[model samples]
Target: MKRLFFQLLLVSDLNVKDKLFKSAIAIFIRLTYFVSDIAKEKAPQLAANFDKNDLKSVETVFKSGLPTPDEYAREKVKALASNFDHSELKHVEPQVKTNVAVIEEQ
Candidate 1:
């Protein structure tokens, strides 16, 4: 059982890492494009074009590689698993009442 649990964690961890890496790459690409766009316009300051969208420069960043739905949901799943791991249920003590009496049948 322990081995199975670890295997499951390992698989899920791999998936999360892949998704996270792709998402990081997407963000980096987007930031790079955004900067290049600002430089293209010969803007004196960043505030002038800070609100402009740069998706035009790298259109595939969002459509091809990103933090997909699976990535979003699995992150929460991992957090819930961590919470279960640290829960007090494993250390909980059974509460019993000593006042109960046993009756003998005649």
Candidate 2:
């Protein structure tokens, strides 16, 4: 099915052996789990930004090895906000708290 194919494609891309790709995927996977609402908000931006240049940014976050997924997502989001200079960055903290509460209840 087309849906399955797309899912496979996404997963394959995420599983790339490159450290930067892995780090970005870590961030994305964590977003999918802990903060899915925020993930939804970020996915499109991530898709658009997932390029050679963005990999440099992701790489800059990890001097030695990959960080935890939450840390990756936070840095990635902050990087995105800095590039955009948008007001949406202001909403992320409150959403993070709400999502944490939701996860705790589960």
Candidate 3:
């Protein structure tokens, strides 16, 4: 049963590192939803932790959503080119470099 659950949680489309990150995000979202539902049901006061705007954002994501990866990448490139700030690049470059290094190491 444990093995089956683990397998079910795995997303085979992603390579190992991506798979792990995706799995973690997926688990976090599931846990968040579960806790939110419990709070809404049993302890209404706890639901205040997730504000109206946060709930609306989640609902919009589920209903409307972000673009496809290709579209998102193209838009990101356009935004980066237009905004083109060295300060932002400093923040972004390290994360990209770290992710690339980790993937390569794996």
Candidate 4:
């Protein structure tokens, strides 16, 4: 009985979160799918980053519109800085911005 109720709660929570997250994202982003990977390591950057911590970063990034990489992401998100990426040098951009910024170079 308890397990069944937990499952029901999870479903409803997902529905509410889906609606809310989509509605918020639609306000600003207009993204499209792209193919990127190597050998057998292929996945969407956004989804891959969000999946870092059981999808917690999904809620954080989606809510704040931050293209955050895992471990660099925040939780309980609210408003973010317009220049959120400028964590250090204000006059120059970082060589490596985020996890997805640069996959590799040879």
Q: Give the number of the best model, judged by TM-score.
A: 1
* Tens-digit per-residue lDDT, 3-38, candidate 2: 554565477676665667656656666555667577
Per-residue lDDT tens digits for candidate 4, residues 50-89, read 6457568777768798555662554323335554666466
The CA lDDT of each predicted structure is 0.62, 0.73, 0.74, 0.51
lDDT of 3 by residue, 1-106 (tens): 4454456456444446666666775676677678867867976666556578887888888866658888989999999899877898799999999999999999
Clash counts for all predictions: 0, 0, 0, 0
Residue pairs that clash (backbone atoms under 3 angstroms), model 2: none
> Compared to the true structure, candidate 3 yields what TM-score?
0.26
Q: For model 3, how many clashes?
A: 0
Query: In candidate 4, which residue pairs get closer than 3 Å at backbone N, Cα or C atoms, i.e. clash?
Result: none
Q: Lowest-scoring 10 consecutive residues by lDDT in candidate 3? A: 5-14
Q: After superposing candidate 4 on the true structure, give the runs of residues whose Cα lies further than 4 Å from its correct spot.
A: 17-106
lDDT score, candidate 2, position 16: 60
Worst 10 residues of 1 by lDDT: 94-103
For model 1, which pairs clash?
A: none
